[model samples]
Target: MWTYQHSDFLVHQIPALENNYIYVVADKHSDNVLVIDPALAELVRDACKQLNITPSHILNTHHHWDHTDGNAQLVAWYGCEVVGNAADTKRIPHISKTIHAGESFDIGSLHIQSLDATGHTIGHIVYVIDDALFCGDTLFGAGCGRLFEGSFAQMWTTLQSLAALDEQTKIYCAHEYTLANLSFANSVDGNNPELQARIIKDTQTRNMKLPTIPSSIGLEKHTNPMLRALDDDFCSAYNPGKTPLEVFTDIRSKRNVW
Candidate 1:
């Protein structure tokens, strides 16, 4: 588990069920603890138990089983409210409250904002709490999610919005896919100095069996091919003469096969 402390809340990144990470966020000012994208109940249950916390909510980024399979079990144990995208209420199990994109809400002292991220799956949404982004699979380190149920255009727009966030923002995506993503990124943008450094650094992190997640938006903007796909120079280097969206589409297509 990776723990991040803030003035008003505590975040615990719990690795479970292969690559998935379940985040347990405890608000310092209230009894409201939130579990985000829990892939299994035991890990989260154990973490909360150790922290002496009773979760007040289960927050899902999408209705995918890998992200929500433990929702029912957690809810049964804690009777916590489940929050997700309003359009996905029917899909997200045991959803109790619906939130829309651009909407802001408070969970105790933790201020939260929602962003529509529908490329990984339709109705997929990401949460922002302070500078930490629980993006599920919408965005990944060095890459982005596949267009599973959304169009390339939709996913492109979503990436644009997320890339525009504060550079200091920390990304808490759901999976451990950085190494493979870096491999693909190197194939397309191998000469990038920042990416080369990141590959070496993240390689060491993984070699030590530590998580390489919680990558900063600033680092990603400088290294991730998907985010860099927005740059004209990147487009010229890879898919010459293509527009930003065109470059993004080309990268996604190549990544799909890679």
Candidate 2:
């Protein structure tokens, strides 16, 4: 487990089921806590016990089993309200509150706003609270999720929306894929100094057994290949005059086989 403290919230990153991350966000001033994508009930429950903060809510980004497998158990144990996209209400177990894009919710004094990120899944959404973005599979450190439900254009639009946030915003994506993603990024953008530096830095961090998460939006803009799909150098491998969405689709196809 790794922990990060922000101005109004404390975030705990609990690794579960291979590379997946289950986040526990707690109010800094009170016992109010919100668990994000509790994939493993035991790990989340034990972490809550150690932190001395009981979860009052569970926020889901999508309907994937790995993201919602613990919902029923956690709701049964803690009676926490399960909040997810209304479009995925039937898929999210024990759902108590169905939210839509642009809606805002609260945990203590922290205000959380939801963004429609429906490329990885039809109901996939990312939550923004203060300076932190709790993005599920929509965005990764240097990669994006596979287009399992939405179109390439939809995913590109979603990425554009997230990229428009403050450059300093911390992205809390749901996987430990920085190293692998950066390797692929290096293969595509080998001439980028920032991407090379990030690869070295992330290698050291992983070697030290540290979490390489909570990457900043500024850093991703400089290194993430998916976000750089429209860059001239990045699109050089494809045909000229390709639209951003077309370039993005080509890059995604290459990554699928990479």
Candidate 3:
């Protein structure tokens, strides 16, 4: 067995593409492991070796280069099944299982759930395991992926689904945009004490050369101005008299340029 019945899963954060964070999940009892968004295959492979884990499966959240750049290499190395959104096999190149939203699978003792999130990109997806969510480029700690393939409405709905998860879920988003996103949050909602406090914490993380990731979903709900669309305080600070969606639009725009 790669993992004992009660062993907690392990995750490794691999930095890439200016700020992208790739993840690898593994079972501790045995050598089996699964790679998520293998942006750097060799690094992922080496990391697995150092941890005494062997990659036998891969989950790609999207077809973006930063997410799937190492797919071919990793697949060749592990003979792993490459999983992704069914609608994106043509673009993804190595998708062995074209998974749908809500599909379930097993990785060691963990039962995984796939959530389709089409906002940053049309085929963007987030994978959930236990209390950890591998949200490729959809929901971030304090921001969201750019509207590269879907509408704000789509992203909005997707975020709501993620928020509906258990409050303690550790969100492993795909990038290290916390500092930049927090900067934009402060620019728009400086009066929000929670948001302000989060910015301080994010700064401290960066100052310590630590990744401000694996952020809890509950904290994101309270401090992420982008995620607080319905909050009157957040909306009022950004647009003064704008509708909720308008406020959301403006906040997104500033984030775009941030």
Candidate with top lDDT is 1
Candidate 3 yields a Cα-based lDDT of 0.81
All candidates' lDDT scores? 0.91, 0.90, 0.81
- Give residue 15's error in model 3 in angstroms: 2.0
Better of 1 and 2 by TM-score: 1
Angstrom error of the Cα, residue 61, model 3: value is 0.6
Candidate 2 TM-score versus the reference? 0.96
Task: Please identify model 1 stretches exceeding 4 Å from their true place.
Answer: none
Model 3 Cα shift for residue 20 (angstroms) = 1.7
RMSD of each: 0.9, 1.3, 3.1
What tens-digit string does per-residue lDDT give for candidate 2 at 183-247?
Answer: 88887788899998999999999999888999998899889989886467666654577877888
lDDT of 1 at 51: 84
TM-score of 3: 0.91
Error of 1 at 244 (Å): 0.6
Return the lDDT, model 3, position 199.
Answer: 84
